[model samples]
Target: MSEVSGPVRVAPREAWLLVATFLVAVAGLIYELIAATVSSYLLGDSVRQFSFVLGVFLSSMGAGAWVSRYVEEALPGFVWAQIGLGLIGGFLAPVLFFSYAWLGAVALPLFAMLVAVGVLSGMEIPLIARALKEIGAPEFRFENVLTADYIGALAASIAFPIVVIPFLGLMSASLAFGCLNLLVAGLSLWLFRARMRAVHWLAWALALLVSLAALWQSERLVSVVDASLFEDDVILSEATPYQQITITRFRDRVRLFLDHSIQFDTQDEYRYHESLVHPVLSLAPRAEKVLILGGGDGMALREVLKHDRVRAVTLVDLDPRVTELFATNPELVPLNRGAFADPRATVVNRDAWRFAEESTDSFDVILIDLPDPKNITLSKLYSREFYGVLTERLSADGLMVTQAGSPLFARQAFWSVARTMAATRNPIRPGAGLWTLPYHVYVPSFGDWGFVIAAPQQHRPRAPGLPRSLRYLTPDTWAAAQVFGSDIGPVEAEVNSIRDHALVGYYNEGWDTWFR
Candidate 1:
């Protein structure tokens, strides 16, 4: 009879059950990824985000696993839980984004969501593994369960950055993954309707419908929140490959914020950059080829361009968008006086470490206008290895000036840079004079900021020899600013010379006090 048809072998429904299980897993992981990224971009403190998120996620997952072991209706419980997870994670991303935009608060609600999703995610694999074993699959097929789990994770990680984030973006990506979870839930419910009680089928259907509705409305919701949070008539806001670049202006106080760290509040930025650049240049009468690392705002270029004799001003900033924004934005262009558009200056958009690594030449005066080394990337530039490359690039008689992180708040951090520099050479004295200045801008948004300057390594800084328009720098006032407190005498870590992360650790501790 029809070649004695082999008993119609429809693959065991549980095999397909495992596939649906993976879709739920994908939704949970995407929620975790989006929350972590939003927090990182908005919060500016990665260590805290990574630590808090990793802990909350793993611990919540353990709780979820514990609960799964007690699931009496393992099959229906597994299916319905998967459906609930789809509903939650599907909309979780947009929800978090709106919350941050509205409340400027995320940690509390963020952890709660993490725990919820982690619980759902935690139950998925174990329940599926049990379901398969019940369906006559060998108990030793644990390898199959593990393989299915990891391969799904691989697909998700690949899709997230490559496809989801770039094309669908955060809000759409989150909801879309949610829908995928719902689809998985629906299919599992449909295939097992005979085994599932009728009430459970209705519950799964309702969850699926709710997930789809949320997916449809997520874009509108996220767009509204993005507008509310990033408001300022948002002249320009872009997420660059390196960092988030946002520029906002209100009446006269034009501001540029990089990764939520205010780079300049134009109202009183002059106090900071002027002190940073003019002091070092005043001492060096003949500074022709100046190499600047990390002055993306073009403010330092404005100061260096004043020399007129600075034949080649090579400014290597990490973000081209920062340079471009300053160069083009009307509000910012006037602030820097279009210094980036200067033909004599060559701006290179590159990481300082990598750029320093591959450099072929030296400069007369190397001015480091880098931010505080609160993060590892900036820490690396302030490290001994980075400074070693820098030392090689300096003219033997050339002077170098680094805007060491504040002397008042970060004495250890500031002195660490000085000590780190001295550790490389013999006979370490105050390389140049030291100058401390408090920058006051009436930061309507943030409070007053302070910056400290260490004069060039070898020579004393003179007053401003150039007679042009000036706001806050003069030769006579230079020496007096270098005086330090008796507390600045010496540090405990002597061998903290080179190749260790002592400087970064000290910086984090100092900043922790500020953040606290």
Candidate 2:
């Protein structure tokens, strides 16, 4: 027989106690967010981190439930669980980050942290149910505890991105949630004073107070570690539901780092944006209505805006803060020349794949300026399935350009993207695609960054839209970018199709070597 039972009868006053229990449940949310973001920050890709944490947490929740069954002492179990929950959950973020630093890998730590949080988080609901059960009524109180738990979850789901992450960042947010857990614990002690021991009250009170103090200092501790990780001085660090965004400046350069990867370092950004924007725009003879994915810094927008003939430029970047900062910051604004504020632009802060699949619109040109496929989340963007969506949105004479990483560095990754697009024959069956396009790589900052200008028909060179401050690209350079030399070593890169998981492999091989 199961030891767990429903509340036979419980009063309104005890329902408020269950609400306190709900606060500890909110700690569950902190585990999910931190696990996802911390992994994406240290190791890239929100999707992989989220999936792993979710799986691990579910398993840990089961472990916690089994452990919960051993608690014969109801009030003591509930009290210690809250106190223990507060102590462990409160310290999770900083502990995990330091663990990650010491371990030099977050993949395992992320799930491990979630597992710990899940154990504590798992204890909350059952403890609340137990509390309700002890309050003279058992059968009917399960519904009320569930109702309170659900309400806490609803609040946490909304609050995590909108408030928690933004205001508190990761460490402080976890600290605050931990404090909330302690508050629930403290409140339980007060409400159930008749059943408590003196040491439990005194020891927990001191610990709860100490934890609140630690959270107050969480940002300072995190800032030190985060700043040390980058060459530039970190001026700001904030976490959104999507990613961890950091702004850093070194002398003349203003840089944006997303999930610890550089989005733009103004000093060498010309290489990324110019290489990304120009190769495609130069090949499209009558290109207009351009669709740009993931150029949030407005650097690509700066290049796209140069073409006065282009009608509408739809730049879909995931994070709004990046666009807003680039558009407004005095240092960065000149780089893009306030392109985001222009009437010809529509800035949609959304996932590009979802947007492309849902939109009824089509574009004459599409520029895929996304970051390198460093993890599963980004890997999908380089997949055949995603390219299939891009193919759907291309006009009859449309040209699509994708930033295919460094050919000299991650040659396989670059070629795999080109191969994946070629495999998207689904989009070509019904008058969908052209025969052949151009494959080019540039040496603006990093040498030989790949660009594949894809179309249904054969590649025919078009007029160039040279920028005001041109350093590397010329008529000769444009043609030269197309020619891969013998010195440019060959790599047997796997195709980055959705089913095969290609981009992640290339990214790991290429970037790991480059960093070394």
**For all candidates, what are the clash counts?**
4, 14
Instruction: Kindly report which residue stretches of model 2 are placed more than 4 angstroms away from their true locations once superposed.
Output: 1-13, 101-103, 107-112, 138-147, 358-362, 426-448, 461-468, 486-495, 512-516
For candidate 1, write residues 1-516 as lDDT tens digits: 366645534365866866765666567677787777667766555666867787888788888888898987667777777777777777676777777788877777777788888888888887877777666653336777777777777777777766676567666777788778767767777776666887877777788787778778865665476577764555665555456566777777777777657777777777677767776666664688898998988998898888877888899997777888788878778888999888888989988878877987777777888877776656777765666677667665565677776655565776677766555432123333222232212223333323333323445434457446767665544454555556543355322333566766787787678775
Instruction: Return the clash pairs for model 1, or none.
Output: 90-178, 431-457, 434-482, 463-475
Work out the TM-score per prediction.
0.78, 0.87
Overall local distance difference test of candidate 2: 0.75
Name model 1 segments beyond 4 Å from true.
Answer: 1-25, 41-44, 72-75, 90-105, 133-140, 158-172, 196-233, 319-337, 426-457, 476-480, 483-500, 503-515
Which residue window of length 10 is worst by lDDT in model 2? 431-440
Q: What's the C-alpha lDDT at position 141 in model 2? A: 51
